[model samples]
Target chain A: MKILVCIKQVPDMESRFKANSQGVWFEETDLAFRMNEYDEYAVEQAVQLKEQLGDAPEVTVLSIGPDRVVEAIKKALAMGCDRGVHVQDPAAATRDPWQIASIIASHAGDKGYDLILTGMQSQDRGSAQVGVTVAEELGYACATTLVGFAFSDGTVTAKRELEGGIKGVVRLRTPALVTCQLGLNVPRYPTLPNIMKAKKKEIQTIAVAELLKEEPLATTVSFHPPARKGGGIVLEGDVGVLVDQLLGILKDKTAVLR
Target chain B: MKALLIGEYRQGKLLDSTFELFGFAAQLGGETAFLLVGDETRLPACDGPLYLAEAAECGEYNPDLHKQLILQAVARENPDFIVFVHSSYGWDLAPRVAARLKAAQVSEVIGLTDGGFEVGCCNAKMRRTVKPSTARAVLTIQAGAFPARQPNGTPRIQRLAATGNGGLEFVGYEPAEAKDVDLTRAEVIVSAGRGVGKKENVPVIAALARALGGELGASRPVVDAGWIEHSHQVGTTGQTVSPRLYVACGISGAIQHLAGMKKSDFIVAINKDKDAPIGEIADVLVVADVMQFVPALTARLQR
Candidate 1:
C-alpha cells in the first residue's frame, strides 16, 4: 500500500499576527512556523499504519508552502514517513482552498496512492475543504473528521465524528481519503536518531506553478483584526478583593446567583 | 439570485439549525429552495419548494448518493448559491458538491456584508471579507452566527431518488456516550483549561462550579489530557454552549473554544496572563492565578 499524508505549515498560534501590506494574508516576518496541530495526528496515523503493516506500506508525506514548509515536511519524515514532497509556492498563503486542493490533487493524482490522509482543516484558513475537495478531484471515496480508523482486506473502516459527539462508522474501499480529527492519536515525538535519519531522507521539490491548473475561485477583499465586542474590565489588587469584585458583578448583572 | 439551502436531519427530525439556514437565505434576498435528504416526515416547512430524498434509499448517509441528489436539485433549481449550516454534514458534503460544480466555495462564514461574506482567517485573530469570483458558490454558514427564522406559507415538496452511488458506504452510527452533565442546560459554567496545572487541580474548579450552583466545563486540552470527561468539553468539536454565566478559569480562548461559548450572556475569564484572547469578549477579566483564586472565590461564594 502506498499512503500519502498531506501536511501544512502554519504560523505558530501563539505568535502576534499582523496583516501584510496587501491585506490579503498575515505578515511573515518575525513569525515562527510549525506543522498544523491537526496534521500531526495525520502523520502519526500514517506512520502507525506503516508499522502495523510491517513494511508493506510506503508512507510519503507532502506539504505545500514556501521554503519554511520544508521544515514541516522534515518533521513528518522524522515521525517515520519514508520520504517528503514539498510543493514550493511562495504565494501559497494567498491561494484559496480550492486552488490549494487542485494543486494537491494534480500532484498526487497519478501517484497511485492507495490512501490519502490530511488534517480536518488547516489552522490558518480553517476552511476544512481541502481533503474532501482533493478526494472529489481524484474521484476517491472520502470521509472526514475521523477519530478511529482500521484497514483490512483492501477496505477501510473509519469512525467519524458527528455533531453533538455522535460517531458514525463509515467503510470505503482502497483509493480512499480520510481526514484526521483531534484526539485521534497521540503523535510521537521525533527521537534523536530519527531526527538524524530525517535529515538524510530525500525531499522531492516541485514548483507550485507546475502543479496548479486552476485560478483562485475566491478573493480576499480585505483582512484585518476582528473588532472587539466591548466589555473588558480588568479586576485588580489583591486576589481576595478581586474575587469579591467578580462575585459582586456577577450577582448584579447575571441571574446565576438567583 | 436563486439559492438552495440544504437542511440537516438527524434522529428522526430536522435540526433547529436548519432554520438558521432559512435565516441566511432571507438575508441573501432571493428565491430560496430547501433540500433535505430524508423521508417526508423529515421535511421542514418553508415558503419555497422543498426537495426530499427517500431516507430508505440514502440510509443514514452515503456521501455519493447524497451528492448526486444535491446535484439533481441544483440542476432542477439552477441555484446560484448553495448554503449549508456549518456542521458535520455540511463540513463533509459541501466541498464535494462545490468541486463537482466547479463553484467557488467558502466555509464558516460568520457574517454577510455589502462587500461580501466575512470569515475568520489566521486562526480567528483576523476576519476576511471574501468575494467568490465564480458565478456559482457553495457556502457553509457558521453555527449560531445566524438566528433561526421560520419561513411562512406552505411549501411544495419534490421527491428525489438515489440515482448514483460512489463506493463509500455507511456502516452505522455509534451514539454518544451517556453524559451525566449537559453543559447546554447549565446556567452557570466554571470551565477549566490547561492553566489549571494538572488533573489533580480539576476538583478545585469543580468546587467553584458547585459553589456557583453550576456544572464543570473544560477546554479541549483539559479533556484531551484525560483530566475530565469528553462530555464536559466546550469547543467546536465538543459542544456549542451559551450559558447564562460562564466563568473561564485559566482558559486562553482559542477560536474553536470561543465559537462554542462566546454567546454566553456573561463571560468572566480568570487568567494570570491578562492579554489572553478570552479577555477580548469577556465581560470581566479577572487577572489572577487559577489555583489560588478559584479556591478563594469558592470560599467567598459558599460563605
Candidate 2:
C-alpha cells in the first residue's frame, strides 16, 4: 500500500510571535520552526500502518513552503517515511487554503496513492480546512480529526472526535483521506540510524507555478493584528501567600465553596 | 445582502456551533438564512428564513455529498456570504464549498470588523484581521468566539431538492466507552494542565477540585499523557465549558485550551509563569508553582 502524509513546518508555538511591523501577519523570519504537532500524529500513524501492513509500505511525506520548509519533510523522513516531496512555494506562507490544497491535489490526485493523511489543522493557520479541500479537489472521501482508524481489505474503520468528547466510527473505502488529531498515537522520536538515513532519502522538489492555476481562488484584502487582552490583576508574593489571596477572593466573590 | 449560514447536525440534532453561525449572520447585518442539507427532517429553529435540502446520504457528515448539497443551495440562494462554524464539521466542508463556488474564505475568524473579520494565527499568539476579496465569500467562524443568537420564534423554513449520497458512507459514532463527565454543565471547574508535574500528582489537583466542590477538568496534554481521563479534557478539540469559575492549574492556556474554557464567567489561573496567556482572561493571576499552590489552595478551601 502507498500512503502520502502531509506535514507542515510552522513557527514554534512556544516562541513569542510578533506581528510583522507593517502587516497583520507574524514576522516569520528568525522564528524557530517545527513540524505541526497534529501532523506528527499523522506521520506516526503512517509509520504504524506501514508496520502493520508488514511490507515496506511505500510512505511518502509531502510538504509545501519555502526551501526552509523542506526541514519538516525531512523530519517525516527521519521518522521512517520512505521519501519526501517538497512543493516549493515561497508564497505558501500566506496562500489561502484553497490555493495550497489545489496545488497538492494536482500532484497527489494523479499519483494514485492508496491513502492521504494530514494534520487536522496547522499550528499557524489553524484553519483545519486544507485536508478536506484536498480531498474534495481530488474527488476522494475524507474524514477529519480522526482519533482511531484501522485498515481492512479495501475499507477503513475510523473513529472521529465530536464536540463534548463523543467518538464516532465511520467506514470509508480506500484512496481515502484522513486529517489526524492528537492522542491518535504517540509520535516516535527519530533514532540515530533513521536520522542518518533520512539525510540520504531523495526529496523531489516541484515548483508551485507548474501546479497552480493562473489566478488564486482567494485573496486577502488586508490584515491587522488582533488586540491583546488586558491581562487582569497579577498577584505577587510567595506561593502560600498567593494561595491565601486566591482563596480569599474565590471564597468571597466566586463559587469555590459552593 | 443575503448571508447563508450552514447548520451541521449529528444524530438528528444540530450541533451547538450551528446556532453560533446565527450570530455571524446577525453581524453581517442582512437577510440571514440558515441552511441545512441532510435527510428530509425538520431543521433547528432559525431567526431568518431556513433553507433545507434533503439528501440521500445527509444523515451524517459526508464531506463530498455535503459540499455538493451546499453548492446547490448556494447557487439557488446566491448568498453574499456563506457562514459555517469553525468546528470539525465546518472545517471539513467549508473550504470545498468555497472552492466549488469559486469564492474566497476567511476561516477561524474570532472577531468581526467594519470591513471583515479577525482570525487567530500563530497559535493564538497573535490575531489577524482579514477582509475577503470575493463579492460572495465563505467563512468558518471560530467556536465560542461569537454568542449564539437565540431563536426568536418559529422560523420560516423552505426545502430544496434531495442531493444524492456520494462516494462516502455514514457510519455511526462510537461514544467513548468511558462514562465521561460532561464539563459543559459544571458550575465550577478546577482544571489541571501538565504543570501538575506527574500522574501521581493528579489527585492533589483532584483534591482541590473536590474541596472546591467542583468537577475536575484537564488540558489536552495532561489527558494525552494519561495523567487524567480523556473525558476530563477541556479545550477546543475537547469539551467546551462555561462554568461560573474556572480554576486553571499549571495550564499555559494554549488557544485550544482557551477555546474550551474562555467563556467561563470568572477565570482564576495559577501558573508558575506570570506571562502565560491565561492571565489575559484570568480574573486573578496567581503566579506560583502549581504543585505547591494547588495543595495550599485545597487546604485553605477545606479549612
DockQ values for all predictions? Answer: 0.67, 0.57
Worst lDDT run of 10 residues, candidate 1 chain B, spans: B38-47
Clashing pairs in 1: none
- Candidate number achieving the greatest TM-score relative to the actual structure: 1
How far residue B66's Cα lies from its native spot in candidate 2, in Å, is: 2.4
Per residue, candidate 2 scores C-alpha lDDT tens digits across B1-303 of 998888877766656678788777667787777788654455666666677765444556776767776777777778988998887678778877887777878888887777567787666656666677778888888887888886675677777654566666767766644646978888989998977889999999889889877899999988887889877888866787899999999998887799889889889998877666777789899888889888887887778
- Candidate 2 residue B27 C-alpha distance from true site, Å: 1.6
Off by over 4 Å in 2: A219-225, A228-231, A236-241, A255-258, B38-49, B55-57, B151-157, B180-188, B197-204, B207-215, B235-245, B254-256, B259-265, B272-275, B288-303
Error of 2 at B177 (Å): 3.6
Write the residue-wise lDDT of candidate 1 on B74-185 in tens digits.
9999999999988889989999999999999989998998888999866566788999999999999998788899887678998888865677888888987777778998
**i-RMS of candidate 2:** 3.1
Residue-wise lDDT of candidate 1 within A22-131, one digit each (tens)? 98788899999999989999999999999889878999999998999999999999999999999999889889999999999999889999999999998888999999
Runs of candidate 1 with Cα error greater than 4 angstroms are A235-244, A254-258, B182-187, B197-204, B210-214, B235-244, B254-265, B272-277, B287-303
